[model samples]
Target: MTESGRKLILSYYVSIDGKSVGPTNGMRGVMESIDDEAQEDEYVRQLWEAGAFLMGRASYDAMKGFWPVAEHPSAAPMNAIPKVVFSRTLDSVEEWGASSIASGDLAEEIARLKAEPGKDLFAIAGDSFQRALIAAGVVDEYRLWVLPAAAGTGTALFPEQDGPLRLR
Candidate 1:
């Protein structure tokens, strides 16, 4: 947990070059080629521990289409855990199970969620949303799965910072 009494965890799959565009071109193949069952299990365990998922419009859109239909080992927890999609344009999120739309101030909304009694919040969003969170200095921990290959061209996971962030 953070000083706010709730941990904000940012988890993502990045390339060796730090690109975070999901499974584009040959990236998915590269990621799958690495046979690491233990690591995969640990990642799934972490996902199961999250109290809720935080996502942007893009990730929420993509996940809503896929996770609802996909038959995978992580599907159960992925569907069970509550999700919050931060989008100003979206009026509602009924299609995505256990989800709600957050159209208000991002920081305030997150703070409210943090104050509530729950497990750590897991963040998985598009670059723009993630950039906003990083700029706000709200994330408590970063959990990245660095793949073996490069994405060639895509969004960088971390944006330019005004100052260095010290991590323990």
Candidate 2:
């Protein structure tokens, strides 16, 4: 947790082989194998539990086209939750109802957000975005949804560091 007592929860969907994207490298394609409504319901609960959501431009672009008109149970919380898109080139984030763009230093931006008084910040990001956060050591907790399939050779979540990590 940060000094503000707010936790930054980094949530992601990985393959059974620990790949950020499975053989398909697509969310809908590979995640379609999940025939469990219980898992989805739990995810919805988690989304509602967050005070704000964070993402990168790519994640925002992909979601902007879908979540705004989505029919899934998670859509409500997804659309309703305040969002922060961390990007250096995004001109506007107003397309989504409650969103703002953060185009500052990555670690500085994370620190500013973490210092804010609110519920824990939630992030569901693409591999590159997630890896950046991991590399910066800004994430307080990681929530991995291990898919029941192998990735074959998908992108890894954690970026290569100078040395091994002793994560708990």
The stretch of ten residues in a row with the least summed lDDT in candidate 1 is: 20-29
Off by over 4 Å in 2: 22-27, 159-168
Candidate 2's residue-wise lDDT over 1-168, tens digit each?
667668889999888877776335664476976879999999899999898999999989989989989998889999999999999998999899899999999889988888888889998877788888888889889888888777767787764657875567
| Residue pairs whose backbone atoms clash in candidate 1 | none
Clashing pairs in 2: none
lDDT of 1: 0.83
TM-score (all chains, Cα) for each model: 0.90, 0.90
